[model samples]
Target: MSQFALLGKRRFAPFFLTQALGAFNDNAFRYALIGMATFRLGMSSQALSTYNNIALALFIAPFFLFSASAGQLAERMEKARLIRIVKAMEVAVMALASVAFMLASPGMLLAVLFLMGLQSTLFGPIKYSILPQTLHPSELVGGNGLVETGTSLSILLGSVAGNALMAVPHLGPQLASAAVIGVALAGYLASRAIPPSPATAPDLRFEWNPFVETWRVLGFTTRNRTVFNAILGISWFWFYGATLTVQLPLYTRNYLGGDASVLTLALALFSIGIGVGSLLCERLSGGKVEPGLVPLGAAGMTVFGIDLYFVRPHEALLREQNWWSMLSGAGGWHIAIDLVLIGMVSGFYIVPLFALVQERAERSQLSRIIAGTNIINSLFMVLAAAFGIVLLGVGLSVPQLFLTVAVMNAAVAVYIFTLVPEFPLRFFGWLLVNTLYRIRREGIDRIPEHGPALLVCNHVAFTDPLIVMACVRRPVRFVMYYRIYRLPLLRPLFRMAGAIPIAGAKEDPELLQQAYDAIDAALEAGEVVCLYPEGGLTADGEIAPFKPGISRVLERRPVPVVPMALRGLWGSVFSRRDNFLRRARLPRRFRARIELVVGAPVAPEGVDAAALEARVRELRGAEA
Candidate 1:
């Protein structure tokens, strides 16, 4: 089913609405203040700028102060009730906002903004933590995509509405105030319908000192090196996004010579691109959390961002252009497409990382992890603002600054990928499968999404493990024959993947023992391991007799064993069909149609070598 189908489900829709509305109100209120200060009060430009800076600082302060406490609150209570309470706080803040708008009290509005930020800080942890509870393992990427799409659009619409509404005459403030307050109430009503999400860490102690708890939660988030690195990636994205987006107004006005309507068009295109890209993730990943998309996305962001600088009009146009005027001009369309593609790739960049955090973080401390993420995000935003100031203050043009950040994105991607080699390795596998084969999966969901399980498959080609790893979503440690594992081209990838190389007792007794030890250790650590019990690839296009090595591994660790088969690969170039002299021939089955059929997991006790072999044969029958 499509991720859009989730919008109709009671389990997700209400919370989706509540979160989107909260986002809408927050942006609407903040932008309404900017509009009011800019147009209504007739303040000096310097004074308006100072007020804007103060407002931004006030809103961000709560995240630094209360995120850890908020995380604790989210963990200590049921998510539905906590969300409702946070919504109630928003309503109160909006009520104060209504009075402040009527009285035109800058101090009152600033205080209300601070309160809004506090509410958001409290809601932050629950926002993501509730997702894993409400969504199926297969639906995580789709769910996250939908939420991101809604948020990006909401923020865009809310800003437009707030600015338009507040820029009017005497009754403008009244309309903006009423609009935001109503949205808050509606958000509260929506929160009431959210299904209960039980607290993940109800029994855990929560520290009262914000600083100490902040340190502890951050520690928890970093314990898993991959998850922490993913968080860092996420934070960097915020920095990249904030830096790029904050420049849009100046970029549109000074460089493109566009009016407000044109800026709106630019924003719309970018946001819509994000929505499209976010929705596309489920289809691209086959309902799995595919981190491989990260490198692809990071590449697109840099490529398009750099292209944006080159395509921009060299000399700024003196007169402002409207939407139609720009579209009629050559320069306008290129810039628009660049923004949209950049936005789309950004969606590609973030959804997987968010899904990864949800998938990998310990269930009990998920809320704390989310809180840690929010803290880091806020910090990055602050840094991004400073980054922009430093660059622009140095007399660089907006496009030049954009060029710098785009190149920096590549550097950052390299650093992160170096830290987590799985990213690039998985990217290669995912890229290969998508580009080289039309793959159809059957019963692939039968394998568990989490916990320890042993997978046994017919070894078809050298790429068997890579194909399976790409499809299974979670990382799988493959056990391969020592010879194949030692192959020059494949060895580095295998070692990075933590694949275990095994040999028959006669071939190498010590190596065989070592492989068994590694397999047992992985199972005990709750990781998935795949074994090709055939010992080696078939010399002919047929299944090899199952070895008894699997039985010994089962005897030691006794985990659920899933039987799977690879079909339509026997005649491919990667198979024995290519003799050594003919190996350089063009792929016999280039872009071959392939299928992976998975059977229900077998309980270890009843699983002997022969029975599992029969299951795999049955799955592969009449196909390979």
Candidate 2:
């Protein structure tokens, strides 16, 4: 289903609007405070900078201090009720903000900023952890996409509204203040429509100490290596975004020679790019959580960021210009495209990581894990600010800082991908399969979401494993002929995927037994194991008699066997049709339509080579 369809559902729509409104209000108030400090307060440049930094610090402090408590609250109480309470707090806080705006009290506004931060901290755990409960595994990516798109657009609109309204004649502060309060109230009304999200751990005790509880929450986040690394990836993204965003105003004024309106235009383009990228993830991933996109995103961000630095406008053009004038100027479009592409790649990088965390973390601890993520995110943002300050203190120009960040991004990406090779391995496989074929999967849901299942398929081509990997959402270990497994170019991918290499019993009895042992071990670890029952690719584009080795493997570890069939691949470049060498020299069938049909799983006791072969034959029909 289209991700937009989620907007019409009761389960998602109300929460989406509430969250959007809250985000809008937060940005609106923040931009208003910044505008006041800069233009209206008559403060000197250094004092204005100090106040701006203080405001940012205040907003981030609550995530560090209160995320643990907030996570526990969401776990201990009904989520919808908690949301309503948070929205009500927003309304009260905004009312106080209105008073401060009228009285021109900067201290009160700063306190209100801290209050807004506290509210967001309380809502963070509930926002993310509630997704898995409300969305199916298939819908997680799409759902996350919609939420991210909404957030980016909200931030854009709110920033525009706050700054634009506050610049009005005489009634500016009142108008901005009223706008925020109205948004807060609207958010409360939306929260009222959210269906109940019952607490996951209602009986759990709460810990009030921020230090100890923060440690506990972070520990929960580290329980799974992949999930914890995914969180780090997310936090790193925040660091990147925070550093760039903080520099934009100055970058516009000094580097690009653009006025405030041009800065707004740049930000708008970035926001729109993120929204587009986030929404596209659902379609790109085929409604599954595809972490492969994360690597693609990271690569794009590094490439585009480096290109941005090289393409920055020369200092000769550093004179203030309006939005349109800036766009029409030399090097303007390049800078704009770079910023937009960077934001788009950031969306691709972040959405999948969020979905992976949601799908992988233990349910009862999911809230705490998200809370931990927020704490880390806050830390990263703070560090990014400090890093930027130090770089600037060392006399690096804004464009130079961009170059440094791009280089740092590359280094960090390499480190992370090396630590978890699965991401890059999957990216390569995903890229190859997606580029080579238009794969259609039928009855894919018949495969279990979790647990050990033996998958038996009639392999039609040498690329069958890649095809299966592309179609199935779960990680699968494949058993392949040793020769194919050791193919020079494909060996690394095979090894990374942990494919078990098998030899004929007559050729190597020890290797055959070891292959069986590996299959059994994979099943014991609750992983999906797929193997071609015909032992090798079909020579005549027809199902061969299934080998009995499957039965032997199941004898040691009896598990459900799912039968699958591949169609429209028999004559492909990778298939052994019309002479393998001759076929390899022929034109590749790029983007060929292929179908993968999955059959109902048969219990181990009922599974036989002949029956499974018949089932696969039925699925394939005469397509081959």
Name the best candidate (by TM-score): 2
Clashing pairs in 2: none
**Residue 263 CA displacement from its true place in model 1, Å:** 2.7
lDDT agreement of model 1 with the native: 0.86
* Segments in model 2 whose C-alpha atoms lie over 4 Å from true places: 41-53, 103-107, 313-318, 578-584
lDDT of 1 by residue, 1-624 (tens): 889999999999999999999999998898787667755677763455446656766787788788999999999999999999999999989998989888888998999988988999999999999999999998999999999999989988887888778867778889998999999999999999998888887887879999999999889889998899999999999888877766665666677776556666777888888888888888898998999999989999899989998998364665478778987787778888998999999999999999999999998899999999988988887787777776776777778988999999999999999898888888899998877787899887899877999999998777788789889877899888889789999798889889999988999999999999999999999899999988888788799899888999999999999999999988764777776345667667878898999999899996789998899999999777
For residues 330-372, could you state the per-residue lDDT of candidate 2 as single tens digits? 8889888998999899999999999989987889999999999
Candidate 2, lDDT over the whole model: 0.86
> What is residue 543's positional error in candidate 1, in angstroms?
0.5
Q: What is the C-alpha lDDT of each candidate?
A: 0.86, 0.86
